[model samples]
Target chain A: MALNIVVCVKNTPSSLSVELDPSGQPKTAGVLYAINPFDEYAVEEAVRIKEKNAGSTVTALALGPDADQTVLREAVSRGCDAGVLVTGTEVTGGDTLATSRVLAAAIRKLAAAQPVHLVLFGKSTNDSGAGSVGGQVAAWLDWPGVLSVKKIESIDEQAALLWRMMEDGIDKVKVGLPAAVCTVKEINEPRIPSLKGKMAAKKAVFTKWTASDLGLKPEDAGAPGSGARVARYTAPAKRGTGLRIAGGSAAQNAAQLVDTLIERKLI
Target chain B: MNPQGILVVALNQRGQASPATWELLGAGRALADAAKQPLFAVLPGGTAEQARELVERGADRVLWTAHPSLKEFNDEMHTQAVCAAAQQLSPARILLPGSVAGRSLACRLAVKLQAGLATDVSEFSPSGMVKRGAFGGNLTAEVEFKSPIQVMTVQAMAFPPAARQAGRAGEAAELAFAPAAARTEVISFSAEEAGEIDLGGAERIVSGGRGVGGPDGFKAVRDLAHALGAAVGASRAAVDSGWIPYRHQVGLTGRTVRPKLYVACGISGQIQHLAGMSNAANIVAINTDPECPMMQQATISVAADIFEFIPLVVAEIKKRKGVPVAA
Candidate 1:
């Protein structure tokens, strides 16, 4: 049986150069956005799986504003067979719960046409880094979810063997197929986009789905349905200016550091 | 359900409550006190001793479950057990430690309860607001819950563990619930080869970056750490280069450490790396490039070759400590 894999991607500010307005909201007018770094790994893993499974296809999906199409295009250029952009004003400023609900709805719609064998996500996004959506999506779909997966040992029609990198150790787990897998950066080295792939991506027609298109009412999506809200923003407190220690040689510097540590009783 | 009290899901490893659990309790106590609500703690698959310890540590009421299926850290079972307790207790706020397992459980619980969740939170206000870093720590956002039930995962070391009272006692109740069959099963767990050093709890740390050159270059770093009795840490660059394991990595995508003294050897601090250790009490940077961000942010900047400097530092420490130097 041909496998259907869906890779979720997010478009975030390319750099940490965010400018907060007076209300502490990020002013994203001039900031450039790119595919989240972790999602690159997800796309790569999906593409590799497709390559291994000759009849399989990889679909990259993103839920955001219209600009998110750029991320979908990037995913297609990297290796995804197709691109999907799920957009709506309600999708903006949604918390992980709302976002997962919307994405789950979209995935369910897609699964109706063709059953999805595997769902993949970056361990977390660079912006939120909450790393909650994958598990929540899995719950909505009633499938098992695994986070921080470093390696996919094997996968077949029945189940998948995975190695998840934990804080103190690695867990080897076997989850029945039709499961959600969140990938870590250590999983694989992502391939660069080829010219032929870029050409295909440029001409690719993205399947666009709005909240209504996904059968989600305004109250069931976006901030209205979000469980949490960012009430305010503040810059982290600054640290004290450092004391520069100068010495004639490396040994002298080392001696000075030792003295300072001893004086402060930090050692 | 009319939520009324604050609930803390005590995280346990091998039946012992994790240090992060106590930290969450400390935060929960404050929130409960300010709200004038009862502070309750739930221990999934925990022992009687662990439950008693939590009560002494400020939990007004302790709810524990030792379900047979919950012998280990199974997300589904743990989540089900905790949710069952929450559903019965009707907690207005649920707090968890922001560990790997904690976050996963918090997410699943949020989905089950339809509660608002904020993970990796550093602070919580009595008014139901949470402060957490976003956009790779470049920005901080204060979050609020829209749902009646609020869920949050506190960052490790963000709050000090609650102190145990000598005679303080609280009621301990057994939580009875049957867990659903888990779709995933853990085959085995293999601990990392790294030594037993809790980076989050360490007072002093010595971290190396890619500039350490190679895997063998970590020798000097390990030596310095050994002399100081400190934990060893690495930048994402070093970990990604395969010079060291991810367990030692200190960065946005890795462990966040707030040691009293952080010594950076041959590390040109990236923003992601700095986010992990910038909260340290004092930072020392030793690198060739003086203009690097790590140098600028360090409390003490030493512009020298770490290869040459670490040995002398180790020797000086050993000499000061009255240890004989090898010829």
Candidate 2:
């Protein structure tokens, strides 16, 4: 059977060079956006699995504003067969739960057209890094989900063997097919878009879906539906001025450090 | 409905309450006291001993549920158990540890309860505001729950564990709840051969980065840590290069450590790495590059080859302690 994979991607500020508005939200107006760094790993992993499996199709999906189309386009450029952009007022500014709900609804809609055998996501987005959406989506779909997956040992029609990174060590999990898998950076190196692939991505037709298109109401998704809101933003406290200890050589420096530690009784 | 209490979801490992559980109680106590609400603790598969320990640590009441299937963490079952407790208790807020298991379970519970969820929260206020690092610690944001019920996961080491008072006591009760059938099963759990040190409580840490060269390079790091009685740590680069195990990794994606003294050897200090150790009381950096971020932020910056510097430091420590160096 041909596998149908949906890779969820997010568009975030290109870098930490962001200006917070008076209300503490990142000012998005005219700011550069790129595919979330982690999501690129997910996209790469999906493309690899597609290359390995015959007749497999990878559909890239994103839930955000029109600027998020750039993320989907990047996915297509990296070898996704199709792209879907789910946007509108009801899908933006939502917390992870609300975002997962909208994405789950879109995945359901996609499954209606074609049975989805697998869903993929980055371990977490760079901006938020909550790393909860994939599991939330799996719960919404009633499917098993695995996080921080670094290796895919084997895959067949029924189940997939995966190696997940854990605090103590690696967990080798056997997740049944039609499950959600969140990829870590160690999984694979993302490829740059080829010239031909870029051209194809530019011409690719995107299926845009609104909240209503996915059978979701404004209250069921986005900021209105979000359970959490940012009340304020503040810069992290600055560390004390670092002291640069100098010495003539390594031994001298080491002695200075040891003497200081002894003086302060820090050791 | 009147806010009933602040509920803490305790985590367990090999039948004992994990350290994160105690830390959550510390934060929970403050939040509960400020809200003028009771503080309740629930363990999905915890034992009576663990429940009693929580009471000693400041829990007003403890609720525990246990089953053979619950012994190992199954997200589906854990979420169901916690949600069941939340539904019955009607807590205004729920606090969980932001560990791997906690984050996943917290997300599922938020969906099940349709509550506001925050992850990696480091600070909490009685007025329902939480502070968390965003953009890899470059910025911090204060968030609030729009819904009646709120859920959040506290970062490890962000709060000290509650003091265990000898005479402190509270009520303990068994939570009667049934868990759903699990969709996934753990075939086996294999731990890495290297004994993992608990970095959360380590007073000092010696961490190496990619500039440490390779696995062999960590020998010096280990020797220095052994001399200083500090835990050995690694940056993401070193860990990703397979030079060290992930358990020893110190960074945003790894363990967050707040030791009194942090000695970084050969680490260039990416922002992600800083996010984990920036809070350390005193940071000492040894690197060849004078202008690396770590060197700039370190309380004491040593410009030298770590391979050369670590040995001298270790020898100096040994000599000062009256231990004869090996010939």
Residue-pair clashes per prediction, in order, are: 0, 0
Against the true structure, candidate 1 has what lDDT? 0.86
Stretches of candidate 1 off by over 4 Å are: none
Model 2 lDDT per residue over B24-99, tens place: 9999998888878889988889878778888999899888887677786667778888887787788988998877
**Candidate 2 pairs with clashing backbones:** none
**Model-by-model lDDT, in order?**
0.86, 0.85
Candidate 1 lDDT over residue span A37-69, tens digit each: 889999999999999988999999899888789
Q: Which stretches of candidate 2 lie over 4 Å from their true place?
A: A262-265, B198-203, B239-242, B245-248, B252-256, B320-324
DockQ of each: 0.75, 0.67
Candidate 2's iRMSD: 1.9
Best by DockQ: 1
Q: Locate the minimum summed-lDDT window of 10 residues in model 2 chain A.
A: A238-247
